[model samples]
Target chain A: MTSHPPAEGLKVHVLPAPFDPANVTLITQGAEALLYRTTFLAPSTPAALKVRPQKPWRHPTLDKRLTRQRILAEARVLVKCRKEGVPVPGVLGLDWEAGWVVMEWVEGWSVKEAVRGWEKREGARQSEQERGGYEIEGLLRRIGEAVGRLHKAGVVHGDLTTSNMMLRPLGSGGAGQAEESGAGSLEGEVVLIDFGLATQATQEEERAVDLYVLERAFGSTHPRSEGRFGVVLEAYGESYKGAKATLKRLEDVRMRGRKKNSKDYPPAVLLLTDLEGTVAPWPDECDSRTMHDREEKRRVPACLQPYQKAESYTGAGSNPYPPHAK
Target chain B: MENITLPHLLEHPLQVCLFRNVENATFLRQQLLDGNTKFEYAFLDASVLLSRKHVLAACFRAINDMLNDRLKSRNVHSEIVFSLSPNNNISESFRRFGITNESINVLAIKVGGDAAQIESHLTANVKGQPAVFSDEVLAEVCDLSRIKKIYRVDVGTKSDGEAARKEAEAFVLGSMALKGS
Candidate 1:
């Protein structure tokens, strides 16, 4: 979850249900949900309460139904993951009508913070430092496997970033495995969180996109560790049955890129005609009666013509189509 | 009887009493069926409850529903039983969680009532020895197999022992919390 300064105006929206603002401390002001650190079930038991406030601009009925669906969707996905033995925070309590969901509090720092901390310490000793230690590789591998397990359970986390994963300290959790823990400490299970955007889908394309988003996120967020990202993919490749196929699809996703860059076509490009091909289209403002009444101006690549000398046609007899379209 | 006030639910403090070797289970169940106002306590069979937190979670939900006027059952006491349920069926919840005629261990809970009145009334009515209300004590009284069957958990094949139990509890809590959604 992207953390920002708590929106002061949001503090005015009293917490839904019995949770009073006085008792629930605001943790972050996300674009969609307001997260709070509060006690649920019992006073000593800590929980994360996510409140989706009402959008006053929408009709009250629609707003309520929308909020309820979102809350239920997140909670249902979380419960399913927990039942499948996925490392995720369990849903402790949920009040969809109140637009709030309380989840078991995951302790320890986020993977983003942990990685950055490691990077900072490693850079300080750069003179004799070796890039990518065993611990770091293990951590990345763990992250990959955690994600693989989630996907294997037939769910895709729409947003897969380091910040969304938590490193719950180990050893205390079970019996064995007293691993080393000091500087660049990554000794914990990678617990994925934030199911707000997750969906139940086993299609390889969606899974590939999920991984693509993570790859891009990891590269941009931790450029220094980008080189070791391959280790994560390698681990993910072996984690499940269709994982290799998903990785293969990841190659195609990378080629297309994340944005719809079709608009960046040189000056003018062919807009499909006489066909079912449909997408963002240029306005066809001229009617049958007005086709000859209006002068049509079109863009030509600057290489061929200057902007001031752009070609203009008063009627359909002149060229009919732009040179660029051909 | 112990006075328990949950966080965010201080307005509805609870008075809970745990009983062991209850011989009057039939009588208590009868009073509830008779709709006796004097027995306005949430009489739960401790066998179905995993731990103190499990029981209190139901209490918190029931009280919150009452506060918001969303109680699905008759009142807060019956609502507590319904809250323990993982579905919207009220009678099924009562049948599974509510005190049974053969219940050996019983948990008597009174919400927002006179503490002295509840304690005296419970002691005079419930024909059993009062036991400490603790997780360890509840663990002894709780039947893991019954809990697994009720929550539909396959904890036996998962991990076994404390880890398995913890996993089961998390799933059970999740199911209970997400009920009716």
Candidate 2:
């Protein structure tokens, strides 16, 4: 007969022995580790503790290195960004030994949820065509504006999906959607979350690729995206130097690549946006076998080396979205 | 098993000089005899005494030297030693013994010998405990113990140096006694 354990104390290490199994709430469990909302007592604080799987399939040494690097890198990036006046969470504490990062827990729905909520509301209000355009477009434009500011501060949102933006309340009891844009401080702002892939960059191409990825995310997730996307570009243009020209060149290269090999260019609307001129042309124009070979060469004049070099400069090699490079 | 408080020991100079360090003993005696705090220069050799009585008599002789030669009445003694402990609870003990100012600097020297048994003892004691003591409590205990200096603590169990092991044991025992008292 097993005796019931006592209700655990306030502050508890998320390890063996004293850990109460009942108190562990699993948020998302991945191959690497499981994330749990754990409570600690002495001056009681609730923290999201991402614990590595006790028995990992990967090699232990490599996994440990990866864990150390990821935790350190995330903390370093956030601290640097915060110092630069970026709206990022303050690091509460860090224990490399435990591989746990304690950060300020944000309270708000993700942009995806917000968009879905608006879609549901519009669905109730009208028919499909009438429902599609205005409201969702407005939401995407706001996301774009947020992305523009991030780029202006030379911080790239490595993973710029709608899921990463939290649509928090406007602030101080007002129902209006006021935010912490480039004005006096507004408490309830639409903040970009998840700095897992974030890194500092000064290159235009790198910034362009970041915008490209977010544009694709907007198009794929929301309806009637083109005009809303233009609004985003408009804001980005206002924020980023020579942004419209760079975007135009990026679009031209994207079109040439599409005609040359349709297979390489997936039918994703935002695919053109993510092409940051990172792919370079052959040093000697060696491969002329492709269909739109001439057109491709004409669009990317300095080849893709300069652009790819720029990408490398911005710490894109370590990005997790396409893990092979790192 | 009770530890002596540092401040209390300082109140009686002759007793402290005899039991503490030979150098400290010599310095205090000279200061007492001189009846002054200002120093030009003074020197005394404590190791030359032929017997225990010779040392006590020498201490008295040194006191006269301080009074006649240096013109100082105040004596402050400073000494350094090394020890390893399972816990740093002496500071709390010092506070409890009423040594209000708790800022004492201690630097630890690592001893490769006598680590295993020390670690085993520490593991047995604090393997699963929390919120043990306040800094004030630790300082109070340290003051009460009269251990003005310490170093080379092996808080883990992997036994190594014979001499250092003994020293660490004495330090730990002294601290424990202070806690109990």
Candidate 3:
């Protein structure tokens, strides 16, 4: 599928080296990042390359720092999930210096599309009985299990939306079968995607908020299937040992109201605080021993250490010969 | 020589040759150490290789790094060997994946070389039986114990063979992609 045209002036910046600009297709543009469906390693192996473009409005140093932190944070979380056997995309490759990450391209439709399609078909047929049947229940259960697995792994997807979750058909099953089965069938494994806003937290309040966000997403996106969302909670409650407490906390979160707007805080700032601790106090000082010392404690992977150091020293300094200049 | 153009890099074709029961491994290592231009190739120990994908992943990484001007080693040939390693140490990577005196099966790779020239060069330098560079052949020579040790994967006893191999491969690819980070 062809992606929407990228915002003005972003076309040149988002393209990485070694890839012909002709081959890169912009999949979607979000506030913080642009999703491009491209090939990685080989032309045959499709990958989703998310590029956090350098924000011209912000200070160059701050922009670079945030871009690096968010890219690394997302890659780290995806790697952690893959190792733990969570049904998330494997991180294929990443270049923090370029502000991009290439992940395994999942082949399927989003849960939002599938659910809406199902609801539309069911509404037309007035099949209330089939609506609450095993097919939909199974889908909800899988969604619960996937989310539970994420939480169990100590990660919370800060933004939980149906659009962010995909319904990947299982084991060689064609997408044709999923489409043929109608929207209500709910056939396929629920795979979570777009962990850009995700964080590593096991706190009850955080988990509750995560669930509440999904609940709100479900209610707004698929009102017809709103009644069946409880099935998701039922399966989630039994997914892990701590899930029960998180469910109990969800009640309190609902009463208190979901007030925190992720948009209020700079995405990079939120990601940095979540992944590491506080942002380095001195953005200007090239040698922040405390920053490096703290990062070292976090076991910053060997490959990323150099970039971290470079970001500290250079901090938004213009490249002597930028790739685009060539 | 089996000349193949990997998916992403159509311009830089690779000439590959596999040899089993190699007797001249020490001489091959010496040639590489002396920086002989003709011997500029990735001479990998086949026992450490899991499959065609395993070797190709390293090749892909090396070429990708070279294209991005991010070579951490001397050249793309050395970078290919470094790509196989899960850690960041360059010499350690060469020791783990590159040719050694004790290497019994060798997978020699030369990028962008004449197919006939590479085949003749490989034939003259190595004393071994030429083997088809295929995953099936590599499977027979691959030492699971050594691969596990090098990659540090357990492949737990309870898991079936297919599942265990898949798990190990997933871990290996993840490690390769995250080698420096």
Candidate 4:
């Protein structure tokens, strides 16, 4: 449906478009929306605007409420990330109905593309004077460590993939070439993006699923999965040194699920509910199968008896990770 | 203060009104109190020699009128206005006026000094913000003679101090004349 001021009267902020209409260019079109690169005249700066459909379907009552909540939640996540020195865009504007946000656009390639090119360059046997290859393994390790920091802060990104990350010049003052090899470790600075699906999680289950999703994403997208993904785990282990027990339990959960013979993958929402601090209420329209599934988990086999005693229980099932919550 | 630009002034909740006398002002106050409207700063302008109740009522009515419109609309609601006045309760007044997170603007015109002081006060407060005053309001104050006389004066509420009212009217009408012609 075409977006027009509704009969109820569309509420607009009355601010002029920051960028000249002619200057704004469409960058990408995905399932949800289209992105545009625009230059906001006030700050004389470049910004990115994500434009979503604005008709009734786009801003349906339920979707609008959810979208508004997501925007607020993402802004809060970004604020937390910024405080912890994560490199994400600075939010400029939030127009909920318009489904648009203006943010300081970072100029860089995705980590996914960076890793691919790194491997490609290394195999080419280029001259030493040639443009140095971006350290692919180091980049993955940095991503893992960043995720580790996030989990420490009690946040599960729900979606964490290389495509959602951006790598820029490592504090080289501006967007300049790499001057020193170790002066700015390529792994030293990486920017995380897209926290739309993120939620607070204090349990190992939710955090583990988040990492699992990323691992699977990497395996599917990147050419070398085994060795490259190992580097990511090593760095993650270093960052989450105190929580090895939790990681071990996550592996156990993965193994158990693997043997279940169920082809259906559980949604992240279900996993988030299993986290200690996360308490997800059943969906309003949950079917009979979900009710049965809930009943099944409620049974709690005695095989988990010794496991339950060793862990400091958080009422139901406690995570065996670091006892202290950040 | 510097001139309030159209853009910046748009950020605040603003309102404008036209009226004849004390009765109108009184009527307005009853509505505001009924509507639970409040003002941080106000400029209620009417002839001092006339009934004080009507002038106050008109100001309150104008404010009440502002809130009836959609709170989220770009146009200012007639309910409240804001300036950088140090009124202690002005912030609270903003809430009473139904202005959620928006800025506030209100004015109470003093009688008998230079009526033009209203313009100066508005000018000072508007510093770098924009305000849109109604043409009808300008006509009621006798500022605009060029626009064909539209509404017959409601005789019941008309006041005697036509000259000072004319001076106040001139500011809005005069600016419009320059812009239109």
Candidate 5:
């Protein structure tokens, strides 16, 4: 599963009105955004809040525009899925201007962690030949069905990793026990999450790429069950009306390969540099003390001068959301 | 009177009273139109309400907006009525969800008011039999066809039952939360 260090200074950034900073727990800091667990509406009701911080490396206008657009797009897709009766988190609340989207927290472990945990326990108890059990196949089928429903709703999860899908425990408030004992049960409904890169597309190629991404994720993450990956496609074929056509397109997606250079830098790093400009002086080829004096002397590289001016302009001038802005 | 401290906004307790057959809705609506401070309660038409959760979701939205200083309506009480709407039209929301002369079953709500005072005021003003503000009572009073029409929910495919009601409620909450987005 994807993991990152606990956000050191995220509380300061996230603790606005309504949300208590102490109540916010950093769940994961992915490459794109930070996932925080916090309460919404009430303390008893949990929510997953995804915050996309400002990117200082990019032009501030472009950064603000992208953040607002992406959050709204994700929220729109989730609202669409919920309306279509697809199993996904409902959009509880969102602030595109502030760059946060709060979603109903699905209670369960990720499919990756669950399946791997199950495999480890089962392997310890049984023979290697019997490792690929019916439970594993059942879980794969559920994943396929969940993806099929998502595609049927005319949405494609651009990054379809096993980690993005959660297996929600059947009964309410049973997540703790389910994790302790039935962690490897392969039961419960599969609920999809993390729609950061999701888009509304019904194209066969897009659908194929979605499945292919999952296939690659399953193979890389759970090699013990790699042979049974076909079961996922098999069940997916029966999920919706045109699922079979999408599966046929998966072959072409596979042949063309999936590795394309995508923007992978975390926005936090970009934005942080904008604030401090600590890294800008690195290419000056000066010693630490001299660099400090040189920085004050306006000796910044000609290439870096424009970015320095943009950072200051964004810092003191631009307000992304005006007073009356929605 | 039911004093409900909705989940997040515990600071803003609500004084709610549901009536089965209100006779003075016209007077109550007139008081609101005149901006009388005494009639500051949200006088909602119960026919449009679906369940306790439905009412609570609207309350949550209004209170949340109040907290955020983003209320689109005149006050929290009117904001509560507006919150039930699936669209952004302010006056249209008041017309659809707010009390009118013809409204019989009424759901009276007052935010941050004394429960006893609000209850007694509602009882004296509204000539209606007091009813329990429960889902069962709401189910009986709710005009489902009118609700689906107002919200533009396509009920043609959904079979009539508790499941369908729950689905509709989910849609309503989603739409309310997404208002002005």
Candidate 6:
């Protein structure tokens, strides 16, 4: 009966005040937030509504505080990123008391969908598929540049994966073709989204960890194209003055990850059944996190790890901004 | 007068009327400052308004905050003017975004009133040519330099056209949304 009713009998389906159910359609129901596609300002302009419903499992005050803090944090980072010219969704509106934030609706397919679609089509092409190499590689470079720009702006996205990146196609057909074809063409700008676990940090370790997380994400999902990730590193190395140093630090982070993934370490207790949206824990929650690096080194399916050495990128000059992880 | 009913807040249907080349700016602002109940409308200087969406967004915030009893100003009308600001300074917001004695293009917004009655009152009081409330008209009236200085954006340097305008609008809306947070 109340807006903040006990979670035992409450359903998040009931949107907060000012949002009519008839107007907003459910986009995706994530663990914390229920994303909705709705029009804002005018009927024609689309926007994303992220609502953090009460968690009945936790204490009411704590749950409310967490919800408020996270919603504000995410909004703040997004605004800061936008002001700094990072390609992220701009915050259209936010209501911390209502546990909701509305953002500009990104119109394009996810990089995950695009890359997977291209891979699927490549298999179909058999031998002649080599021609598509340039396109896919270009997409990788853009991803690298996007992350670099994000880091340059002094925010680290804790969870970095292909799924978190969007390919806003250059042509007029981007949004129209989102659901139809991810395999069609890979020409677009890489816009990062879902900064639920992002932090405002400039430490090299945090930045390395961000890159390391992305590296693992790519390695796990698209093992066949894992080596091509180096192109991402290369482009990132050149994006800004501090990018090269960050790349150098990425090697140390990778070494530590490899050490953790070694065969003798607790027999890999962490089993991620669904690799998609596997969030890299925030620094405070690192102890409770499950890190599954099973067969990380043993599964060497490819031969060329060319350009994989991040040390070569150390020539990046010093920058005057704060920096973030994978 | 254009009767604009936002999708979500249908209960608060707005009666909006835009005016161009206002002949008496000082008289209108005087009524607001004098606290005339008859002139309890959001008298906005249309030069700072980027688009129809910008005006709608401010209205949405004002009305929504009023519904939730979170209004920071005198009333919803004043709150609408405050919402247009990128920061919290109620009176300053009034000075910057609100109608001033020098305002030429003025936009009159009434949250919920009889369309014909409000139109008649505005026509009788305000001395300006009534213009359709549209983006094209707003674009013509918008002073880009003032907007850039207020929002602290490089909207002036980038001449990439429509896309750039939309991007600037996005930042402005974002700033307004995150104003009090």
Residues B1-181, model 2: lDDT tens digits: 0111111112222321111112233333344246543321122211111122212222222232233342122221110110011133433322322112222221111111234443343234222221112222222223211322222233222233333332333333323212111
DockQ of each: 0.66, 0.02, 0.23, 0.02, 0.23, 0.73
Q: What clash pairs does model 3 have?
A: A118-A183, A118-A184, A301-B181, A302-B180, A303-B180, A303-B181
Taking the tens digit of each residue's C-alpha lDDT, what string does model 6 give over A1-326?
A: 34355678656466889997778888888889999999887787788999988887999899989998999999989988988889999998888888999898888878888888877777777577464677799889999999999999999999999989988766532355554544445777889999999999989889989998998898788877886889999999999898888888877676567645554233333545434357543332232233244323333222333334444343456422112111
Runs in model 4 deviating more than 4 A are A1-23, A41-43, A55-59, A126-134, A172-188, A240-242, A256-326, B1-181
Q: What is the alpha-carbon lDDT of model 4 when measured against the actual structure?
A: 0.47
lDDT of 5 by residue, A20-139 (tens): 555678788977688889876556668888888777688999998998889889988888888898888887666676678778888877898888887787779756686558878888
The alpha-carbon deviation from the true structure for residue A56 of candidate 2, after best TM-score superposition, in angstroms, is: 2.6
Q: All candidates' TM-scores?
A: 0.83, 0.44, 0.78, 0.48, 0.77, 0.83
Q: Which ten residues in a row have the lowest lDDT in candidate 2 chain A?
A: A178-187
Ranking 2 against 6 by TM-score, winner: 6
CA-lDDT, candidates in order: 0.84, 0.43, 0.79, 0.47, 0.79, 0.84
lDDT of 6 at A257: 74
Native contacts recovered, in order, as a fraction for each?
0.80, 0.00, 0.31, 0.00, 0.24, 0.73
Selected candidate, larger DockQ, 1 vs 5: 1
Better of 1 and 2 by DockQ: 1
The best candidate in terms of DockQ: 6
Per-residue CA lDDT of model 6 for B1-181, tens digit only, reads: 8999987888999999999999899999999989999997999999999889889989999998999999999999999999999999998999999999899999999999788999999999999999999988998888888999999976653256567677788788888988897
User: Can you write out model 3's per-residue Cα lDDT over A1-326, one digit (the tens) per residue?
Assistant: 12567677744564555555567777998988988888765556678888888887999898888998898888888877877778888776667877877788887788988778777666677656665545667788889999999999999999989999998876522346655654434687788999999988879899999999999889889877887899999999999999999999987777666433334222322334364545553342233465465534444334444433343333345533212110
Q: TM-score winner between 1 and 3, please give it.
A: 1
**Which model, 5 or 6, shows the larger DockQ?**
6
Which residue runs of candidate 2 sit more than 4 Å off their true CA positions? A1-24, A30-33, A39-46, A52-55, A127-138, A172-188, A224-227, A240-326, B1-181
Docking class of 5: acceptable
Tens digits of per-residue lDDT for model 5, B3-114: 8875436688888899988888899899999999888989999998978877877887788778878889899999999998989898999999999899999998988967
Go through the candidates in order and give the C-alpha RMSD of each one to the true structure.
Answer: 9.1, 21.3, 16.6, 19.3, 14.7, 12.7
Candidate 3 error regions (>4 Å)? A1-14, A126-132, A173-185, A258-326, B154-164
